[model samples]
Target: MARRTTDINDIAFGVIRVRMRLHFMLTPKGDRQAVKYFVIGHPRNGTTTLHKLFVANGLNSFHDSRDWQTGRHDAFSDFGQLRPVAGYDRTYPNARFILNFRPLRHYLNSIATHHQKVFSVQNFINEAYRRAEYFAWALDYFKGRDDFIAVNIEAPGAVRAVADFWGFAVKEPPEGLINNVSTRPKLEQNSANIETALAALDLVEEAGRGCLVSRLNGARQTALLAARDTIRCVQ
Candidate 1:
């Protein structure tokens, strides 16, 4: 018998069409209010959890999905690895930004592990490090801006903080992390390489201070401590 085959392009096109229909259906009929929140964060950083919380509270929120046609969502989260495009703030003048922060080591580990599992190879280390730097850059670039609030999703009270920032009430935050990839067992194998690459990047020390850096090892701990001190000295 001939081997069965699947047309990947056809499947991709079908998915796109489905997404388009979904977006159209979710779009508001009348001229609704402008977007209230824009979550500018790296991938796998609890954006999904946050989006769920928002929706459960009756807010229309979407994660990692852009809707250029409708522009009717109450909140938007997860733009993947790339930093916010130029004039993002200008485009959404009234929209506030929720900047999510994650530790460099853990962030890279999760992404690398996920890539390894999905692609059957491990080559996302550089891309992960680049994303980490992008997060750091976003923090510095948006510093002191009243419209932007930086929060580490791992922290306890993060959901409440975000709600307070947005002038709303969330009776309960999500219990645990969401969209998290299983990477703990693989961290030992990947941490050293991730640490080495991150150390070389010109990351903003101040931004590093606010992250939830995991206690991976002495070297990683020392680097985080140094970065934290740099943030203090500048302040």
Candidate 2:
């Protein structure tokens, strides 16, 4: 028979899943609470802004490429909160996840643009290979399970198309924003690019059954503020 087990905290370039295994609820004494949270997505999609918003709301959040490399952050290192809890999900299990989404060509362009700025003009194949490698890493992390929540700050149709193409797309954009439009950035979503992104998302989601907290890309500020409020509410 196939093994029927799920990893506690799994993450990659795409899906993130945390399994909540503890029945005991713990609090950080009095008014303060240590609720762990992570932001999962492409580099430029407002991860920095969200990190600031969480801090502004008095919630503890961390972000950095090194954070992942060193496994200093929960999403990378511990799988879950370093708290004493059984199973991956139950460990620092109270934390939530924020997954940002951007248009395909736009996302690709942003990465390519940044790569070029950092190094030199990159060839299309080089960019694609880098992106594919990132996606593969993400897929490795979210390889089996759900119990993690995701928030998308991109267009749903565009997101779906991209995820379908790339093999990721964990959760369908939430219900309310299904028809919502985002103004964040103007990018021509070519059919081919969309397909690639979608494929990536699908693969990630399959490995991990995560939910989608979709938001209109146009209302980035609103989304940031709302995320801040959410942290505050829990705090």
Candidate 3:
């Protein structure tokens, strides 16, 4: 017999579930507080996997940014707004934030290749350079926070680390059961040569340094910086 789902989070991703579990998850999440979490990561960074992880643990999660408004999602990810959540703690006590980042060269190539499905690109070099700044800034902003964590999505122990941070039961993460993949099982494959793509774009030197911090207004930047400094001093 087929199982039933109560949350809309289970309904929206039905048409084409990418980088997500191909099977339905029916794990019962016991009662818990109303703490909300927002994942900070770009496309192809396994944000979908993380979203499903929360869903598997019984937290109603939304893959889209706007879904948080329906009052259904206890978790939110893939928020394309590219904005900062500086005072989330003040707004919602015990709110959690998570960031997933990767090296710039790989990131540039991954996104460019992902976009190749729709609009052809010479390698999305320009867009990569811009996004690199945002990621870098976000990494620093969320750094050293008590309720925030940053992880390397490609790392073997990445799932364990995130589960630990959230205090989920220590068990093997379920199989990704992806609907499709041309390359990485967790992500859709790209025919572009990783090395050739980076070299062709001439992003060699800029690979190490990137993040998009442009959207931050002066007040937010100052507050984030001050908070980080204070947190450091206390430690």
Candidate 4:
């Protein structure tokens, strides 16, 4: 009927208008503003998983922040090392944000046991504190708003939830779906570093840093020799 045709036209026009508004928000300054979504927050908490979902669903996505700055990316994952870039949302008010996370020990354990970065336990503790700050600020700023979503990728139906959040059809699972889940395995670190790591950890935990820093004492080091009481309990 003519009425039905008119309704369809109106819907199509509305969509176009939205895209036009977004396009006008900023000139194509760099790889940054071209993006419509910024999947941010600490690593190993499903940041990569969320990004893969976006790309698998056919959105042109980039994983690294620097990579995004060099090209026209529609979605930028892991915007900063462990934080969102300043003024991104205000610059692109139309952009959606996803803060992905997992259990605290699980996150810390991943960082502690990372094959490449184990030598820097102090850095792990430092970054954990930073992640907590980001979460505190983000939750306060973005909670209960439709433009922002906090996704626990480890939670049940997380992938489906993300797809639903974006209203995208998942004809196939996102490529690179593996999450590199946390595990318990003993790893060796220098005793001197362990002592310093724990000292810094205690300081952060006292400051009310979240779960990631609270239980680094024995993370998954059950099998290690008693002399090696490092935070290698979870890997």
- Candidate 3 versus the native: TM-score? 0.58
Estimate, for each residue in 1-235, the C-alpha lDDT of model 4 and write its tens digit: 0001123324653565455445434435454445477776566767677777777878887786343432366677763433333356666656777767765545555656654345555454554445555555565456356766666666677667777866878732646466766564535563334445546555433322223222333333232223122211111
TM-score of each candidate?
Answer: 0.60, 0.37, 0.58, 0.59
| lDDT per residue (tens digit) for residues 1-235 in model 1 | 1111344433664575466556555655333336557676776677887787688678887675554333556676775334233334555566677767665545666666765533211233335334445545554555456766766776777766777766676644456446566644564446556554444443324234445232322245555444433331111
Worst 10 residues of 2 by lDDT: 1-10
For candidate 1, the per-residue lDDT at 181 reads 62
Best by lDDT: 1
All models: lDDT?
Answer: 0.54, 0.35, 0.51, 0.54
Superior candidate under lDDT, 2 versus 3: 3
lDDT of 3 by residue, 129-175 (tens): 34544544654665666787665666666766787778877333376
Residue 39 lDDT (model 3): 77
- Candidate 1 lDDT score relative to the true structure: 0.54
lDDT at position 99, candidate 3: 68
Q: Where in model 4 is the C-alpha error above 4 Å?
A: 1-35, 65-67, 79-86, 115-125, 171-176, 181-235
Q: Candidates ranked by lDDT, best first?
A: 1, 4, 3, 2
